[model samples]
Target: MTLKLLVFIHLLLLIFMAVGCNAQHSPEDFDQVNLINSAGPYLGLVVPNSFELAPLLDPSTFIPSKNVSHIDLSGRRFHVGIIADQKVIVVMTGLAMTYGQGEDDELAWESNGDYTRDIGYIHFANYSTEESCDNLLNNVWFNPDEIFPKNGIPEVREHAFWVNVSETYYNLAEQLQNVTLESCINSTTCLPTTPKIVKVERGCSASILAANAAYKNLLHEKFNCTLIDMESAAVALVSLSMGKPFIIIRALSGLAFSNLASKNAVIALTKFFELLSDKPTNGIEMYDK
Candidate 1:
């Protein structure tokens, strides 16, 4: 009787130990809402500043947990936040163009005969916009122009050699209605109470240019842009590739060729906040998987 009891006890202990080991090695559910990810399906907003995210997120509701340790993009820091019960990631797209120091800066080659600074936005294509991991396993993209009707971002039909800006997003004018442009001429301090959100059917993004002043024709006419920015085109490409809905609201800075020689960063920032704060009724279900 005593020997049988000992065997039973030992067998029970072994069974318990095996169960514990399996639990310890079990995989984690990445779908759960956490500091680094969204609680539900998500929307991606690629903008330049934290304030820019305000239109979609409330500052007080921010999780306060910084998401700076992505293994793939460890060096690059990103912030994750929740907005309207959806996960939203804000990424700042930096400058898109650069060149190397050589006799012919455009045609410089290294000892290995590779172009210097050849690795531009093209190298890490989609690097900045990948922060928001909201994509359906299968998605059907619609013509943004047909759906939104206002489709404000730039539209480039034929690709240019040095320029690759094309595509469009929702209309900022309609989504962010009743915006008025500032007219505080001769001084930056007294900006208009409301800045205009110039929605565009066609626009372009490129390096800072004084084409407006030099050409007398609207610089936008020269580049076919009603809007211009350093990173809009690349951001558009990123969102479109992911099959997620995207929109851009650009506050009208001084005309590219205007005599002001100034940009109303405040207008852009404020308008972004206003639009985000005013939630839209329209949105795509990028998480219906």
Candidate 2:
């Protein structure tokens, strides 16, 4: 199947599920609840920070609604617009995934990297090892690992397993296994291989960057994590608490302990949103088998 079909399938599942499993909230002390409730069944597209948000908000990708005004609740500013024809509310979580130094550092990449490792959509986040792992220079962060039921983790939860992407989305991600991703910064500064989409079984989120090759290997070997980041697992926990469906799309810019892969993030994101624009906004149509 083509990437366009894959993109359509994803958006279809996202919106359909969003509409079907709409969660209602009681009015609380803050009037922000009322404003957000009136926003109507939007696909909440979240990013870690402005760097990731810029691509989605770009004129070529996200088209703002002229009729509706933007909403500011709490400190977060939400932009309601049409992206790839689907109505979405875009917001930045103001989080960071990158830490430690690049190049010249002990943890810097020392060899040629796999440029073909971009674009991974996760099925599960392994936050189970948070308490066991060391913190970022002794700073304490919220432990999402402890919020689960005491009887150990189950295969699925009643409210969709913390915005679980579902087995269907996992299978759909397999279609992009051959999709080409950006691998070069410039002619002379290109990676050795082209990037491709991956189906991540488990991704771990913590405060520290996986800058050490040994540390990266430890997480992979011990936890069976395909990738590590700073925020997805926490987001998963929050979504689970709120009883929502969600998915995380991770664009790999560089490999841990290898050559610093640069510019691939922008390249991968540009390609990603471009594919999103191919489908009709309403997304009522079904994909052919």
In model 2, where do residues sit more than 4 Å from their true spots?
1-39, 96-164, 186-188, 255-289
lDDT of 2 by residue, 196-286 (tens): 6666767666565566565578778866777776666656665444444455566665433012222333334344444545533343322
The lDDT for every candidate, in the order shown, is 0.35, 0.47
Which candidate achieves the best TM-score against the true structure?
2
Clashes of each: 8, 5
Scored against the true structure, residue 72 in model 2 reaches a CA lDDT of 52
| TM-score against truth, every candidate | 0.43, 0.57
Residue 197 in model 2: lDDT = 63
